[model samples]
Target: MKAAFLVPVLAALWPAPALSDGVAGEFDYYILSLSWQPAWCRTTGDGRDAPECQNGSGRDFVVHGLWPQYERGWPDHCETRERDPSRRDTQAMGDLMAPGLALYQWRKHGRCSGLSAAGYYAALREAAEAVRTPAVFDDLPRDIALPPAVVEDAFIEANPGLTADGITVTCKAEALAEVRICLTRDLEPRACAPDARRDCARSRVLMERIR
Candidate 1:
């Protein structure tokens, strides 16, 4: 009886098996080899017939554009919450970076215009490091075989109801300088400001309060 009790306790105390370095290598290869996609945004309706519902409130998920607005801020010329989803009123977005593109191209040079070969090489090295290290993104039990397709699918599964394409990308042409602005003080209330009102009337980026 004592032996049976001790066995169960020992099993419960046992640590999870360590992941094999070989499996980690395979996952790393796939993650680095996968094709990188440019930033893009999209929207989806509830498939309802109601006209009001069709144009009603919807969520926006930006995969990349927010980095510029988030990491730094919006342009100085325009004082507002540049990437607030509620302000868009029509779409959301996501950007898929190429294998070595993420580190070099993300929020650098005013929005991923292009990175030099040296930058690309450095990004690749960084990608390798991300996989080996353990964190929210790191896959445990390193022996598990991971494919690029599988990783992509898993990302989708993780974010239920939200689509990946909702993220949008910006070109180097816009070339807006980065500056921080609050949604309420800088963006929301500014809607009524003379200049902001003019731009809002024409473009109407933000009209209602964004929750």
Candidate 2:
């Protein structure tokens, strides 16, 4: 009888499990995801009227998300005390990412950063600006196929400190999707986690022209 009574008391005092993956502000590094807009349009963005897909939008690589990562795994939708971003905050990111995407990213990955919405967005902008997209991809007049390593090499060349170990290229439906780069909390280039280093294995992946 006494044991049963103590069980209820201890349960109440034990503290509730976090409602999410892990606490915010507790991550090893960051992954800056730059998505190939045209490839996205050809696949998931098809039939969608998003501005990024409009003709002559000139969007090539755009900010996908800034994710908080662990050494081995990653976290998402983590419980945090920071408030969600406001419409103004989301709109401010439109130059780099769609407003809706900014909001979604904030909820999913940004929340795990433990920064306020404004701070997270600011950090995202800083990270995006730090990466230099290869100029060769600026105006591909037509679709082309190339080894994924070539793309990674181009990025490595453009960004001096970045290397094959620090970045990985991803594909969807045989099309170039995103280039993910790992960085330290201070935003310096770092080697990605082993699991995060999975590069697209296709010898020749399609890269759609800029819309």
Candidate 3:
């Protein structure tokens, strides 16, 4: 009788598991964002003291994130049972993105991936590797002004399967900012969602020279 009473008391005292705001691993696709380091340095990183902005960092197009997306919207900060990545795990991604961004991406986007931290990062690496950066941007000797379409064309030309609708170029403060590419859940190139297909319309947007 005493043992039965204790069971009831314990059940009353224990906390219920927290409910996740968004379901994990249920997104329709992914958006792989690549940031132009020079443009970022000139516009934002100049104030943040980011290592990518330091002289000789030699970074051009750097991984921004691999975000899960819906056909109409996107998920963020979803709760998950998987353990958070350790410092070492975030640091390992420094070659592709900043350690701080890696941690933030894991908290905001990675949690919704349904995979454990290790699996999410591995998938991120694979997704980035699947896309090829246009070689024309490499060692660009001087700043140039061009339509955003030109940048998109360069990317589509470099990656055979990537089409006009599969990628979008974004500009910031009249400068080239990022190139966002849509991919299938399995990492194949695909047309972007209507919302994701909003390309920057800036004609003669400045693309800063590589630092």
lDDT of each: 0.20, 0.78, 0.75
Give a tens-digit lDDT track for model 2, residues 1-211: 0000000111101112223377799999999987777776776465556554777777777777788888867788889889998898887776776677788888878989989999999998889888988998977879999999999999999999998899998887688877899999998999998878868888888999988
Clash pairs, model 3 backbone = none
Q: Across residues 160-193, which tens digit of lDDT does each residue of candidate 1 receive? A: 3322332111112121111111122111211111
Candidate 1 TM-score versus the reference: 0.18
- Enumerate residue pairs that collide in model 2: none
- Candidate 3 has a TM-score of 0.86
Residue 141 Cα positional deviation in candidate 3, in Å, after optimal superposition: 1.9
Worst 10 residues of 1 by lDDT: 1-10
> What stretches of model 2 exceed 4 Å from their correct place?
1-20
Quote each prediction's TM-score: 0.18, 0.87, 0.86
Pitting candidate 1 against candidate 2, the one with the higher lDDT is 2
Candidate 3 lDDT at 29 equals: 94
lDDT head-to-head 2 vs 3, winner: 2
The superposed Cα distance between candidate 2 and the true structure at residue 42, in angstroms, equals: 1.4
